[model samples]
Target: MCGILLHHAGDDDLYHLKEQFLEFPEGSLSSKRCSDGSPIFNSIIPYISARGPNYSSLRVSKKYKTAWYSSVLSLRQPFTCQSIEIEERYVLQFNGELYNHEIVHNDTQYIVGLLKESAPSIPAIIKKLNGEFAYSIYDIQNGTFYFGRDTVGKRSLSYFLDENTGEFYLASVTGSQPNFIDCTAGIIYQYSTRSKKLNSDLSISSPYEIATTMDQQLTKLPNCIDGLFEHLNKAVHRRIVSIHPAHIENSPISILFSGGLDCSVIAALICKQLSNIKKEKKPILELLNVGFENPRTGMLPKDVPDRKLALSSSEILKNLYPDVTIKLVNIDVSYEEYLEYRPKVIDLMFPKQTEMDLSIAISFFFAAKGSGYTISKDGIKEKYQRKGIVLFSGLGADELYGGYHKFANKSPDDLAIELTRQINNIYDRNLNRDDKVIANNGVEVRYPFLDEEVIKFSTMEIPINYKVNKMILRKIASEKLNLATISDEPKRAIQFGAKSAKMTKDGNKHGTDILTS
Candidate 1:
């Protein structure tokens, strides 16, 4: 939910270092002094805050020109505990919600308390923690830094390290950097289970070839459903806990609610938790739903009918939570407009794949970004300052819950197999779209359906009948939150909802082009 920038001089090259720091705007700077009387310079606050209401905190070291910027976004309010500290020469930044924080805290205190007994290494401390997290710890103590994006890669952390300067910049989104070093194209490495070690990285000519090999190996694993669910749930819970209350109370968390089970579930869970906390005042939970205008003549596919799921979803949500503010945007862009924006959308979403279906999906993302949900006060003048708003989406629900027509013939055993396959496919297909659309605006995204706990419980314990076409989720919604009324209704993809006119070209039909065709 924030951006961090650091500049270091290998020798007495202070002039260039200062110039680099000045390139980002003056108001963006914030300074704090360390225990050793060194000043830490930071400028990410103004850049992030102008995007929306958020709690911004910064730490900078004057001697090192090393800065750490952290912001708790209102979109991720009601977080557990969030803090960044500089201990000696090391800077630690963590976005996480530890299930066993109290226990770990006490253990750390006890260990640190018994200085005469022994001390734990940094790696040992990391091993004692359990949860979903993406953290970067810069050890100025050793002039070396370490960063990891959790074991499951649920939380995102991307960085570009300067080989010439040994300077590293890290952010939650990949495209945040305007300029980056051109690292050679392909790299591959494998982790050894027996040795519990990672192999040295290797470069390859074709990344897809390695990916295919890995996919085949992953498909061979037993209990794929259990493993997939476990990882997914862990991802969701990690993000939920990462929300800081100060940030939530300041700006309010925004949810892209489609009234579908995935987004609806996330909205419900966040609302349920926020209602319990007694903050400065109850933060607003904003729900954004986008609709499209009528299609042109002959645009409708013979098989697909118009369905306003966005409007219906808003109504259902209003019935459930009368307090939330729902913003529905009916996009009226013409086919010509779509063509104009198609390339940018394609570049953002399908940077790797140029398939037509992905392009269609990217069009929906383009419309959503333009819907004003991610717009900041500064406007869209610059991409980085557009907004730091974190968008919560439900991208993997259909794939994991058998909500697609492809799962119609799946038996109980076959259902598990298919679900696992779909879950794996999410990273390349759905995650690609989600990340591209939101990150293009400098906004972060969270997928609650991909939560590890929810995935594990739903897949391992819940009966197959419950998940077959979201049957179990519907029942749970009725019993736990009364969500079943709309569960039986058919699911609609965003592309079909927003661009129905484009669906019938060349005798092709909507939905069929994707699932059955």
Candidate 2:
């Protein structure tokens, strides 16, 4: 994940606001360092360097001052590829990834290339591509700028226009907290860039409104289970293989595991995909199980549901998959640690959705910090690859499938409606909050369940009953993958599994209040 900043000062002097743009929130500017270990503030363009520590590039015209910054974790290196100059008339600044990187390195390159060749409409060009991206293309010749994000809203992009100064500013994060972030001026405005015209409201759907698409033909299709499995497997494969240093045979892929059905199924699929890719060079899997210290007991394993469940599943996978090595990363956070990280988590989440802050923050904080170590041949040292830690999260299963307990007793019609609503509203539910929290450590979170194809099939093509309680998913795991032990495990919410929900009981309970103001 990289940071892209654009400041178009219509009348305000750009130099006067240098300190605000050049510094990161929470006084982290001092910690921002380049590849050479020098402070980012020392760079020629400090604001660009501050946002993107690994690499920074800038383009300035009389009307606009743009900065494209990329950290070491940049998926396709937008700093180099997308920052191309064409006749010194057009420039691109991009942040995020394109799944079709083999053909086009970044969104800007693809969009600009299309413009150069045929100059098609922006929406038409976006429809032809698949990936999560936020990019800005400047036409110096026209003195106009075009900036947008992916259709699915997988990446965070926000813009604030100071009507007083006639300056329009766009950033990965618009504000850190209430009454903070002078750029946003209190009102939160996010980029709702989409391919298909979908409503972009950040509202949670009611339980009855969330349901799978009521399609009768799904059950009639031959090899239905295999088809669904293939789609999910492909989703996992895409994310796993996309990691930089592409072929790090020994690198471990991390999974936020609760030993429940959803995560366990993902674990099995990853192992299967890795085995198919290379029988000899099997990838190590890290199951990160976070268990918080109980306030009542002040103990480590204080009856945390995830602890026992994760332990059992880890053992089962270790015994079942010979080629795959399973590493259980146990993250036990003390109450003090939780308290210290809570405010930071809230601030890091742009707009600071306070209602679900504790639960989401707690889960992601531990998940982001969890790491797997590779021991040296002599067994004297361990190594941590900060960039290569790819996180696999079972996020969309609850929305796509009827994994939520609330949906258990819903009628078929209600379930169908509920699934459709949840699927449509999934991006805003917790995706942005989850992304910001996880990306804090530069580790990218990939959700195979949220794959565009998988989502379409699960929500539109598949029947609603198949998703209720994830019955069909369990069947595939037990029958095809031989994971009956985990397939039978009940669904447990991440907050409950990690003891976060219980701890934050008295804290803000109204999520709507956070977004409204």
Candidate 3:
């Protein structure tokens, strides 16, 4: 929903704290006022305004001299303001969608209400947490703060501490800061205003538990297509239904499509749901496909691997769902444009600076930018700047369903261990970087395959036979959904498919190379 920040002022002078980890992106101070009617920030950094382009604010507790900052994207109703405060005793700053449908109108309010009513323990709040989030709740009465991200770490949260004065810091993003750390998901830390040091972390279930739950659910039903289909269907439906009507006005539901198994599967479900669930009239759904113009390989932007795949898949979708208007928005980024955005992409992926990160970020940055074109049925092209606030990403399918082919050769035991590792590493390897890059474009990114239920059913539940090459998901696509070659296409990493890799004469640069520029 927004970008968030919290800082505990060690000294009365807030000016010195501003120049530390916060002095990177740009130096325009945010002008949004807090609920208490005070300026949100005296200074700011990053492309901070972009994350919460709809609303921005800073809430301060004069007694503690601590400040909480939240910038909202406002994709739902109730236009809930943040930092959300309740009973004048508790305050919250959250950045994520509560797709749980717990608070259909305003997720911010739902969470702030929980933080207000729940006990001091972290479990009290986590037991009900649903969907992706990075959150901080302050107990004004007790001088305590609780902060954590969802177990899958689907959102970004970074932290820093100044030991000399026992001051604490947190932010949605802190780019390449000397001491700031991207907080690990599934761990909650409590900070006391009196001690200023952090308390022992309240641990939650490990990501491995998700694997365990999937196994348990799958044991009873050998053929789990019906169950798997049910969960998958619900996952896509909740993501759409949760957005308020007013917020989704005229904004097409956009997909970060790759024309591969993952995105095509999601695209099918979304098309089905808009007709069955939303029932919105002749809704236009955009398939945002990104392709890069790499000169080294003689690859034209229009002919990039993913673009061809998208054109093929677009035809499949059009043939399948004639009721909905399916627009394939080809987001072609030129070499010049890539160079122009490289620096900003690097900054957005703060603390994660690698050629691989840059490539992936650039791919998503342009895709989400949606500044491309949509072709008419008559083959005429029309310029389209996607106002797609809700961007569906097919991110977690590979991690959850064994989409990587290498795991196919591993033994049963090794495969289980590998799957567990993939689940745990998603936070570091994908979610953080992807979330920052996608959100930087002023859009919210959602993972349908990562829905807690979807994870529970896919992990260990579907037969190991189907998991190889993600045959299980492929089966769902082919047998149940009746999709075409999309159901059988081999997996392709987005960077390679989009031609975002090996950008220059450093064409031989490995994907893992630490970015120097």
Candidate 4:
């Protein structure tokens, strides 16, 4: 949820650093000191101070002859000097939530305890975690730093490592630099179920479209439902742990609730957690439901009424948690408005532009960020610093649990394999958009359904019938959370229900877009 900048010896001088810092004043840098222990000089670019927000920090180390700078708007936890470790050969700063911290911490302690040893590879240690993240660890020992995005690339981590000068630069967004390479517009291929093959028609710059193919090998039969539920529960619990109670209590945390099964499940889980904690005053939980001002004629299906889905969702949420506040934002703007913002959204979501077709999915996140809610803890304000804010999203529910109608006709084994393909597609399509848009807004987003624990459980041997039309998920929700019967309700895409302003060739459609300059 914050910004970190690192620079090694390159073409830039002290003045260049000052100018760069001035551009992002909300950023800070490492510094150098004299032998007398007095503050010697600033290491961050000066442009950061003049134009960016007034929140920046600096640290200097004579031992390593290195400095670090940060312009942090903390969402997860407050930034403390003690949390940052500056050694003789390393400078490390991270902006992410370590979901398996408890396990990792325990394992680290156990290993260190047994061998009586200390390890300098924090990144290597961090790779053991099971959640979304992007971070860089500077190793002065090797004169090289290591930066990586999560396995799914949920949290964006982009770097500019100049092979010519051996200098490294990292940022959450591409526009952070004037000379950033235009890596967009590349041919991005994806495994298409509809075509039953890998296709290279998609682009990193385009919107994400949902496409599927029928698998004839799987049978349509009832399967084990309890196992899937067990996995989902574990996933929810892990995501909840990522939400530092201290952070939520200090600042507002917003949830994007479409009233769909995925979001609804998350909402119920959060409410349950809050009640279990027994905190007299709960953190401000803002339920955001975006709807179209006029969906009857302009965009929606002829049979569907305006705001029908949102209304149903809102009603259920109100009945479930009357104490929680719900806020609705109507994006009544025309398609023109959507088109106007398309470019900026595309750039933010697909900085590398390996494909142009992914822009559609990216636009949705831009619209959400424009509403001023950070989807993750890192997206929160500095004054409200804590571990991190956890934004719950229902990302992989539809694909894994067979929420889509496409699964109705397929056999159990075929459905499972099909679902696996869809889940894998997440990385190339929605996952990147979701992670980048939130990270660009300096927020973190957590997907309980996409949790590793849930994935492992759902993929195990089970009856395929239980997954048909999200049968397993609905049963769990109804029994465990006392949620309304979801089996009877039809599955609806959020973009369609929200009456998104984008237009397609088919009609005023949810995922339609016209190529533009």
Candidate 5:
């Protein structure tokens, strides 16, 4: 949603700080300054600014010897700037949405008010937040700095420390800087501004409670499907609403659709929602399917498994929901085009350079770029660039519902442990990498399945029988959603489904292997 950066230092080291750990190139550093005439620690963050190109601001508190920088994409409000001061005391740089109906206009101002009410209890406020976010709040009163992300790391935040100078640096991203690490999800990292030490202590635990036994079997088989269905329906609706009116020509919402069970089920829910809205206000649903051509095998993008399945599934949805309009965007990537963006995308995926990372990021990179084709009136393969800035991804379904192939072999006890492990670690493995790649194109990706309510219902309430193969979701698709034939679509990785894998051509190379380059 936005990019944030902060640096804290003492008087002795404030002016003498070197770029050993937080260096930027010579000319890339923006000469931008704060409200007054003073500069903002001379912030150098050209790498992370792509995520928020709409507006950029830098605020410096020379009294506190701290610099705060933020750039905004402005998806929620046209003029809601960052580094928002709560009652002009607590300085906050927030990136991501806060889905509370009571606070309508700006989430930052609303959150600052919440911070005021709870004064310094950060975790208490974090527990009340039901949406995805990554933020840093500097309590000018107590000189204690705090930063963290939502329980489900839906946004990206990276940080580093200079041991020699005791200067600390945190940003939405600091590209390829050695020892610069991603802040873990579900943690409140803090340090005292008075001390000016570079070390960060685990401030406190988060609100997430993983179920040791993944299944409760609380709801009977008949009602299990209904419970999950209702939970997911509300989740999808929460993300879908609050879209500002049709500012773009076509639509503002899209799904990173592969025609798989996870994505198709979301599409079905959106279609039903779309049907209920009036005809004049209908927001077109754009389903984006990406495929890659294989130069070595002489295979074309159209022949890719993802392309075939997407075309097949489009017809089923069309036949089932005649009233709703669905646009299937066939995004074909030639071998040369994939090579063109590979270097930049890999740069965006920083600190995570694996053959598997490239394969997965490549699919999302093109999908977020949103340059593809849709059938025009004349049935011509017309050139179309997706106007939607918000893309829905079916990311957390596998971790939450045991949709992975590896989950098939594990016993119920082991399955419970593995599911907990994967979901917790998803921040570093998948969410962080995906956020950097997708947000690099100035688009926001939301995962409805990862919503707190949805995750709680699926993992805690649903039975193990329904969790395996994600039978509950399949049933919802078949009976509840009325996409009968789609229930058979098995789980497939985007790399294989989109034909982006095995292109590294490292003979018998595994996905976990680090990139040779």
Candidate 6:
């Protein structure tokens, strides 16, 4: 949600080459001119100002000869605390949330407080954190830097290291860096003396025990439908109540709803949770569905099921939860608009994989860009004044619950093994792409299905037949939750469902040239 820049000034003339290292391209989104009309990228090494408008702070460490800069996008808490400093010997630049901080302490503290409790053993500290985060801490005493992220890799971290000059650049945003290397989650990088070398040590796995507990609970229950429904409900409740008390009031929650089973389930849960909260003014629910149209026909592409299901689902949700204000914001995108923003999307995305992945990123780009509300009656002209700061995504549900058609007709043994593999490796498959696209719009995305507890139950405890293409999920929603509208909604890939791929192909054929030069 925010931007952070960290650099190590180790006996090099960084000031002379600052422009070469910090030049912002013409179309980059993160780097911008400050209030004083000076670009933040031109700031002094290790002393760059914060990146976003939410909160900005700078800290200088004479002891370690380092400077830390953080632009905080307030997620669950405010910006009362500064950089993470332990005994004035270590300072951390952090960029994510700590979901389990409440149980650790009942104070207005952040991961810094939790970190102090688990100090002296970095691996132990990493294991204790049950949230999405990416951070770099400098050890003033040892003259070394440590970097880490969560197991799900929900936060992006990249670094540029020049061994010959002992120069280092690390940041949470990877705009257009030339030779930056991606940091893997669940591993702590311990940068030794600048001239020596860099090494890494594996961190501990997620401390999720919901799988064993869910199995035991299901044994006691009469049927599997009740068991899955109960566990999912608890998962949704935890995510909503986990936000800091200060952030809950007047902070609307946005759901990337396509009217499919995954998103419909999330929307229903949020509606139920919000209706029960004891607040004077209830928070509004914004359901965003991106609609793609044919450039020639000026209508939604044929075979796009999202439009029909999304409209019906919105109507049902509104009638079901009248107390909570539910607004359906439909973003109708044309091929011309798709081509116009295609390069910006691709450039911002960095295109790490194949064209198929890039198409998915394009679909997500429009979805994220369409997060805000509309001021005009047309509803296509988005206003920057978005009421929702926190967006919820049903990302992990597909991988965990076998929502893909490929998982159909598989034997019990094969299904379980494949499900386990997909759940474990999901961080690499889709988290980074989705995380970057969503964060580019200055919104923080929370995944209820990816919560440690939800992951454990859906992947390990759910029975094989129930897990086939989310059969158990549909049954519970239809029979128990009474969500028949979305119970049997077929899964549609975002790119195809939103017609993003078709738009790109049509634009290219008509000589529109979607990629920016």
Looking at candidate 5, the ten consecutive residues that score lowest on lDDT are 17-26
Model 3 scores a C-alpha lDDT of 0.78
Give me the candidate number with maximum lDDT: 3
Q: Write the per-residue lDDT of candidate 5 for residues 286-332, one digit (tens) a residue.
A: 78999999765567888888888888788787776776767889899
Report the lDDT tens digits of candidate 4 across residue range 1-517: 3445544434323222221212123333322211112111232233222212334555544333334555444433333321144444445555445566454332212212322226644433544655655554554555555555444455544444445544344444443244433211122322221222333343322222222332234342223345565666666666655555566565555566666777777777776655455455754555544443332345532123324554566557657775554433222334555567556566555443422343334434533443522223354322212222346677888877788777789866677678767775666556655555554544557777766666655655544556678866777677766676533566876655555434444443333343445
The sequence of per-residue lDDT tens digits that candidate 3 reaches over residues 199-312 is 745766655642333343455443687788889999998898887765454677999998999999999999998776454567778999999989777787889989999999
Q: Report, for all candidates in order, the number of backbone clashes.
A: 19, 7, 0, 66, 0, 0
Q: Per-residue lDDT for 260 in model 4?
A: 70
Better of 4 and 6 by lDDT: 6
lDDT of each: 0.46, 0.60, 0.78, 0.49, 0.75, 0.65
Taking all chains together, each candidate's TM-score versus the true structure is 0.61, 0.78, 0.91, 0.68, 0.89, 0.82
What is the RMSD, in Å, between candidate 1 and the native fold over all Cα?
A: 10.4
Q: Model 2 off-target regions past 4 Å?
A: 15-53, 58-60, 63-72, 75-87, 101-120, 175-222, 244-247, 279-282, 296-302, 371-387, 504-517
Runs of candidate 4 exceeding 4 Å displacement: 4-71, 75-78, 81-85, 101-117, 120-124, 160-169, 175-227, 250-252, 282-284, 292-306, 322-340, 351-363, 370-389, 405-414, 504-514
Clashes in predicted model 6: 0
- All-Cα superposition RMSD per candidate: 10.4, 6.9, 4.4, 10.3, 4.5, 5.7
Q: Lowest-lDDT window of 10 residues in candidate 2?
A: 180-189
- Global CA lDDT computed for model 4: 0.49
Error of 6 at 179 (Å): 2.4
Q: Which candidate would rank higher by TM-score, 3 or 5?
A: 3
